[model samples]
Target: MRQPREKIFITCAVTGNLTKPEQTPYLPITPQQIADASLEAADAGAAIVHIHVRDPHTGNPSMELDYYRDAVEQIRGKNRDLILNLTTGPGGRFVPSHDNPRIAGPGTTLIAPERRVEHIAALKPDICTLDLNTMNSGGEVVINTPQNIRRMAKIIRESGVKPEIELFDSGDIALMHALLDDGTLQGPVLCSLVTGVRYGFQPSPETVIYARNLLPPNTEFTAIGVGRASFTMVAHSYLAGGHVRVGLEDAVYLSRGQLAKSNAAMVEKAKRIVEDLGGQIATPLETRDIIGLPQPAR
Candidate 1:
């Protein structure tokens, strides 16, 4: 078994593609709101902020490059050292039509693989998520085939930005090994084991152990629990020799029946949980070192 780290890093997913504005009043929508929320999370001890842009008026997910540029610039202007992890996960969902199973429905956002990582190549954030799952998601199906993964991976590699592989199931981890073996993905790898989704990896101690065992050598992973399992998995992940993540993206509640007022609120609670367990929260600078990223110039 891998030993638990002396210092753990916390990632705050400020906003996500699936979270609608109607769900929570505090969900960051516009670029300015995203930037502000991310800065707050950083202040509250989040070493990295995972971001997804949205339409300013409707609060729907958007793949516009300008939206990304504005939010990234705002965050970088204030905190040069904070790590920004942009999402390349939006354009992969497909909703089938009732009339024809083969035809894409209204909610389908499937686009060219090159378009998904367009922001990554333009902005060149510290890290970007590369999802490797082709799974059922509610009524829609998220398709990320090996061919598309390789195409997107090529762009991420060319941009000089690290890809934080998002694994939803054990099979995804298996695919990760294949990617590594084929030299499509370079290591030492940084990945997140996402649990608690209904059709994805189940949230439990056994799940964490099983998944961690499947990871390759020199891998750094964060065990992220969605919905109600968010805080519970913090303890589970830390004890299982992994990092932790929490925010509005993963959950909206601070506790049972209580809506979190901001992303920073979630990060503060996650930091407290790790600290109470005698695990230190790594700073952005320290995280850069731990994750093998180059130090920021003074």
Candidate 2:
């Protein structure tokens, strides 16, 4: 592990697309609940809130523009300075039909690339995620071909929203380089090293360092681990000269045999990890500067 950076920023992923409420009752489903979770995370020292909307009725992920709008508006209602990172990663699931290999199966969620990033244009958050790789996510394939990637990057760029590239494994670094060469992705953007998903790289300090070494010089990385690896990787991330992310989206458990009560718990737990390591936790405004963004508009 390398020397820890001066300022460690925490991004709390309040809710993710895959997690269901039945699995964890605290998972925020409604717009109000999502905003409340973001606030709780912010209060717990998360400089940014990585957000994904869900269907309030079913507690499943949804790309409804109104849901995004409501969640963004409510978060900004009190704290405009807290950076909002909306997810553009939905609408890419592809499950091939068994009967016919060419046709999509019932679980397929492929949509026009334009539809995927439509909310970034509407809400204009400080940052939005652009998944760089097309990989097997769970049993289904998450499709983000080169063409679709370039298109989404174009839309996200035009809106002045910073694109945080998510990498599940080492090969995604190649895709990131390709996007950089084609001018689809801009410099100094964020990269999230997402480890510990099914078939993805297992979460560990060595894995974090491997991915960190592959990132471009201009890219800043946030190391996120799923499930049990979540908190452990926080220490690894900091020691490896990277940032950290936590919340119910990455892991529902606060510790062994214990489920996290809220997003705030994850944030607070990770904050302790950062501070205990002789590092300073960046405030939201400080985090904006760390990531090369202007202060919130008065």
Top candidate by TM-score: 1
Model 1, range 96-181, lDDT digits (tens) per residue? 99999899999999999999999999999999999999999997899999999999999999999999999999999999999999
The per-residue C-alpha lDDT of model 2 at residue 232 equals: 94
Off by over 4 Å in 1: none
lDDT of each: 0.95, 0.90
lDDT of 1 at 209: 96
Task: For each candidate, give its TM-score against the true structure.
Answer: 0.99, 0.98
In model 2, the Cα lDDT at residue 147 comes to 93
What TM-score does candidate 1 get on C-alpha atoms? 0.99
Q: Kindly list the per-residue Cα lDDT of model 2 for residues 35-59, writing each as its tens digit.
A: 9999989999999999999998888
Pairs that collide in candidate 1 are none
Measured over all alpha carbons after superposition, the RMSD of each candidate to the real structure, in angstroms, is 0.7, 1.0
